[model samples]
Target: MSEMLEVKEQETLSETVPVFGYELIREVLLPDILGEETPKILYWAGKNLARKYPLKSASEIITFFKQAGWGDLRVVKESKNEQILELSSEMIVNRMKTNGKTTFQLEAGFLAQQYEGQKQVITEAFEHPKKRSAKVQFTIKWDMKDFA
Candidate 1:
């Protein structure tokens, strides 16, 4: 809803998300634009999301949901400290995966389908009765353990 894009990454938690003017566009936004092929698109979206926000820890990513108007994002798995994000939205899920059909619908739908099996999809959504948005729930997982 806002034109100004405020993006930053934090290994350590920093920057608080403001309420309103934010929409859950990750899952819905990426897929429609890049269809048939989902890997490249998902990768870019994940990287971009990681870069845009200072999601240092798994919990922080969850908190981003409430701030971004998305649902309750959570982490259900941990591979030696590496957490995975699961995003879902009933409203957005039922929508088509075609590009440019509807900005929010397309974006939310794309994000949901693209991350399926490829990574941990942690996000959910609810159709706004009056507003032109939905509540998406998802988690963002990162590789915390590195091998040498």
Candidate 2:
């Protein structure tokens, strides 16, 4: 008489999973592939992504960033045609501590494109990395006359 071995079924569960080592893609591979044009390319790519995921309001946009692992996005100041935003996170702080020259061009471009669509005007964004504060700032500006 031969004994048969019983097989166990694998567990199948659904849950939200966090992505790890995204910096390797953002900080290393992308720059290596794009070379000198990394910043510009990433900026345009971010704008393209913003078009795909059009958020209705600034709060929604901020929520999107948090859900997408971008960080905490907050409007520090807003004027007639200009908006200043700050982004901070544990990842950002760690990156700043380890790397002195981190760029946030992708975030800048995303903000620029989103603002342009929301205001129906041509918009531009500049990124300022605060190494000391371990944060990144974005300044989005638009001209009143130029309609998008």
Top candidate (lDDT): 2
**What local lDDT score does residue 66 receive in model 2, on the 0 to 100 scale?**
76
Runs of candidate 2 with Cα error greater than 4 angstroms are: 1-20
Cα lDDT tens digits for candidate 1, 93-144: 4332322243333233333333332344443221122123333333323332
Candidate 1's C-alpha runs over 4 A off are 1-35, 81-85, 96-148
Give me the candidate number with maximum TM-score: 2
Alpha carbon lDDT of residue 103, candidate 1? 33
